[model samples]
Target: MTNREKYNQAFIETLEITADQLGDDLTYQSIEAWDSVGHMQLVSALEDAFDIMMDTDDIIDLSSYPLGIEILKKYDVEFS
Candidate 1:
């Protein structure tokens, strides 16, 4: 899968959400499944998918879907 696919997959599988549900509006606690536990699940998924360890601040700052893309960029996980 591509980087974008992997990224989306991480969110999808971690949060038990559909593809269409993903967007800028998707943020932490925005859905019933995206609680603190889900957030860590997502972070773990992203780290495993990208093979990079996100810093503590980065994890805390990953409050939204769009921002997650930007945060991953800091680790050189390009989308395009």
Candidate 2:
């Protein structure tokens, strides 16, 4: 699967959110399901999906969907 597909699947499965609800603007505080526990789940899901280990900085800085994409790119995950 593509990066976008992987990202979407991870977000959907971990966040329990629909495709329409996901976007670069999506933030932890923006959704009821994206609490602290869900944040950790999201981090784990992203790591598992991308097969990349994230640093504490990346984990803490991944505050939004766009930021997540940016951080993942640092791990060599091409968005395209």
Candidate 3:
């Protein structure tokens, strides 16, 4: 799968949501499934999917879908 797909899957599987629910509007605490625990799970999933260890600051900074992409970029994960 592509990096984008891996990213989406991290959110989808971690949050127990469907791919159709993924979007730029997706943000932490925006859904019942994305609470504090879910946030850590999503962070773990992203780390596993991208094979990168994110700093605590980045994990905390990843509050939105668009921002996640930016944070991943800091680790050299390219979407395209």
TM-score order of candidates, top first: 1, 3, 2
lDDT of 3 by residue, 24-54 (tens): 8899999999999999999999999989999
TM-score, each model?
A: 0.98, 0.95, 0.96
Write model 2 residue lDDT over 1-80, tens digit each, in one string.
89989998989999998999888779977898888999999999999999988999888998998888889989999998
Candidate 1's C-alpha runs over 4 A off are none
lDDT of 1 by residue, 1-80 (tens): 99999999999999999999999999999999999999999999999999999999999999999999999999999999
Ranking by lDDT: 1, 3, 2
Q: Report model 2's TM-score to 2 decimal places.
A: 0.95
Highest-lDDT candidate: 1
**Candidate number with the higher lDDT (1 or 3):** 1
After aligning candidate 3 to the native by TM-score, how far in Å is the CA of 30 from where it should be?
0.4
> Model 1, 15: alpha-carbon shift in Å?
0.2
> Listing every candidate in turn, what is its Cα RMSD in Å to the true structure after a full C-alpha superposition?
0.5, 0.8, 0.7
Please estimate how well model 2 matches the true structure, expressed as its whole-model Cα lDDT: 0.90
